[model samples]
Target: MARSLVDLLTTHAAHQPERTAYRYLATGDCDGEVQELSYARLATRSRAVAAWLQERGLAGSRAMLLYPPGPEFISGYLGCLSAGVVAVPGVPPQGRSQNHRALTRMKRLIADSDAKVILGGHEVIAALGRLAEHLPELDGITCVATEDIPDEMAAAWREPDLTADSVAFLQYTSGSTSAPRGVVVTHGNLLDNQRVITERMGHTPDVIAGCGGELFVSWLPVYHDMGLIGPVLNTLYLGVTATLFSPLHFLQRPDRWLTAISRYRPHTSGGPNFAYELALKHAKPALLDSLDLSSWKVAFNGAEPVRAATLRRFTETFAPAGFRGEALYPCYGLAEATLMVTGGTVGVPPVLLEPETGAADAAAVGCGRPGEGVTVVIADPEGPRELPEGEIGEIWVRSASVAKGYWRNTLATRESFRATLPGHEGRFLRTGDLGFLRDGELFVTGRLKDLMVVDGRNHYPQDLELSAETCHPALRPGCTAAFSVDRGIEGERPVLIAELAPEAVGESEKITDLIRAAIGDAHGLSVHDVVLVHPGTIPKTSSGKIQRGASRAAYLDGTLAPVGATAVR
Candidate 1:
């Protein structure tokens, strides 16, 4: 058995040197320009990078990886692991010089992680040098273009001492509900989670053999946990082939995803719920007719709320293309747990519960059962008692896959990662997500911090947002934010902020009225106020989850600019 990911790569390279490990699509289309890296070549490149880092005596230090979506990022990341360096994966600066927002985010990550080196593509490294004068964050940090390293450097590579408890990487949170914090994940945590994923998703030898070997296709951002651990590293874990494309490409043309799936016929491929919705939006009859997704046995969905409507629509729309409803897998996970905590059984349809009274949607989809060796318990967020099945509470997790804690933030690490239940032994990770377990299955409800308590009734913001978005065609899907504002002694009042389509700017009043009525009818709650802003104004995390707290702040400070007229109730 491989002791670490580095060992796994070395073994694969030795046994199957010519096997393709990864394929990159420059344009996200099947026929577009492509790049392939075999196991042997990838191992050589990784060794080269590891030797360079070792020569600089940077072992045990943090190295920030800032490369665009490509196979190079994988090499840089694996190189860090081989060198016994803690890797910090982050988004690279884009555009001509450097985007201010992107630069600011980069600075925060650099300072937070205290990364000593920055490994990026040649172009990104060159741009960083040009702007070094203005960026104080690069004052003492070393920047290297890993692509420029010679393969001969592999001869000088020396294996560093590694252990299961060794820190592997710091995965920063998406900052949807709060500021991002780096989650400290060790080698043991990583390997255990990979096992959990494999067991829960049924990535067994029989399944792979039936599908002609393991394969995955994804366009998720590499900097994010879902993209990195789920599809990318899983490929390496199973010694399978994975075709990757830029997230920007998928956003530009959602149909490219289906095109690649039809062309490659991979056994597993999927993204967040929004991804399925986007694909459905562009599923023209001609496009659907030309695709064959019969080989896709696992269409895993997570990272965001999995909607029953999306699952039903995507299956119905792609049924002509051989997509199965049983392939629609709904799972739940987070950065704190090193990625997957719970996932649906493979080849099974997602379970949906009947709508509760005053529910926003017709049904709630179950996230799925916990992975092997993972213990999930629902506990009251305000108390120490664990809730029984079918009762909503904070989702607490205890597993080997749970990460060590937050990096360099002892207070946060203690507060979030050291929770104790009355009867459960050992520490449990406080997921900060509210959910309930029914029949041994997990059903995520909403973020504990984002849950709105109006008139002593618990209201999930996602439910309210869903109701508001469906009220008007002008309202953007997955772009609505529902939050509660404190109104002194009057208690918490619900507020809705939605992004309006450009052409619907003049219909703010009508849209606002419709949203108010829709939410009131479904959730039985009157809107305190409705603010319709320009498209893309609502705050969202990198993974596309709505930042309800940020929206609430903007609304309170009067920073949300109205597109037409704000409706005050």
Candidate 2:
């Protein structure tokens, strides 16, 4: 076992210096212009970066990494680890002054992390310089383009003194529920979670050998935990080759994802549930006919709710292309747990619970059992007592893979990371998620804070959202937000905001009526108001998770513009 990622990179460089470590596609097309990096070159570039940081006496400081999708981000990240600097990965500003959302996020991360320096590509650094006047957070920080550092600097690199408990990086939350906070992850947490992923996904030597050696195809953003720890870092952990591309490219043409899988024949690859839905939206007969996915064994889905309909539809749609139903692996994880907490067996189809009475499509999919050395328990959110099986409660986790806590936020750390149960010996991470275990399989229900109680009945927002989305074709899938707003003496009012499809028009009243009827019939609760909005109007996190809290805030402040007159009960 390697002590740190630096050790793994060093060993791989010495043993297989010429082996291609990564290949980046500029256009997200299999036949597009591509760039490849060998182990030796990556090692040299990483060392150069490490030496540069060391020379600047930044061994114990935080360095923000803001780079476009490419190998440069990987090298810069590894260099931070090699130099013992805490790496803070964030999305770079796209040089558009109107992108205030991205700029505001960057500013927030910089302020929260108090990063001493910023490492990025040459172009990214120049773009930051152009916007430096508007960003006071970069006033005293040093900005360096790691690409400009001389390879000769590698000779001056000194191996950082590190251990299992040493803080490696700060992974900021996606803020799907609330304000983003940096989760403090250690080297041990990273390695242990990688081990958990390997074991849970069955990334064994035999599996790799059977699939024609270890290989991966990914377009997930490297800055996100699901992308960074799951695919990219796991590739390095296994010392395998991963073909990379930009997330934007993948979004522009969903066919590229399947095409990459066909070309690379990777043993394991996946993304959030929304990615599969996007692929389904564009699965033309011609594209499906060209795909050969027999070598794609594990398609793990996580980072958000995994809809049973999505799993079934995706499997049936792509089965003609040799995509196996068993390959649709549904798992569960969060940033505070490093990445993965529980995952189904590699060759098993997802387990779906029996649907509630009169609601056949309301079955929840299981997120698999916990990995080795990890314990998951359901406990009441307001107390220390554990909940019985088949009862939904807060998901509490204890494992080596769990992060230390939130960075520089002791109050949150104690509140979220210092949880305890009646007989549990160690602290457990309060995941703020609601789920239940049935027959040892975890079935996530909904977010704890997003739960709504109206007329003395508890309701999960996702259930209402799902009902509304399936009510009409005009309602976009995965674009509905269900939240509760305080109505003074009227108690909590349920509000549903859904985006219309691009081609959907002039039926806002009809669509809103259908959604209300569907919710009333399915959940037996009348919606307080149904607001139909234009496409892409609903707020979503960078990872595509619906932001119910943000949506509620916007609704309360009248910031969300309705497509038509809202229907109020």
Q: Mind giving the per-residue lDDT tens digits that candidate 2 earns over 1-569?
A: 68998899999999989888898988899898999998999999999999999999999899999999999999999999999999999988774542677778888898889999999999889988998998889999999999899999999999998999999999999882335699999999999999999899998988777766556889999999999998899888887888899998998998899999999899988998889989999999999889999888899898888888788889999999999999989899999999999999888888987676645456788999999999999999988899999999999999999999999999999999999899889999999999999999999989998999997788999989998988887777789999987777889889999998756668888888898899988889877888888887888887888989888888877888788855453
Q: How accurate is candidate 1 locally (lDDT)?
A: 0.90
- Please report, in order, the local distance difference test score of every candidate based on alpha carbons: 0.90, 0.89
Quote the lDDT for 272 in model 1: 90
lDDT of 1 by residue, 1-569 (tens): 77788889999999999998999999898898999999999999999999999999999999999998899999999999999999999888897434776787788999888999999999899989999999999999999999899999998999878888999999999881225599999988889999998898888888877766647889999999999998998989988889899998999999999999888878889999889988988999999889999989889999888887778888889999999999989999999999999889888898989786634245889988999899999999999999999999999999999999999899999999999988889999999999999999999999998889999999999889888887887787788999998878989999999989898877788888899899999989988999989877887887888888888888888888998666453
Q: Which regions of candidate 2 are displaced past 4 Å? A: 95-98, 176-179, 358-360, 567-569
Root-mean-square deviation of each candidate, in angstroms? 1.7, 1.5
For model 1, the run of ten residues with the poorest summed lDDT: 354-363
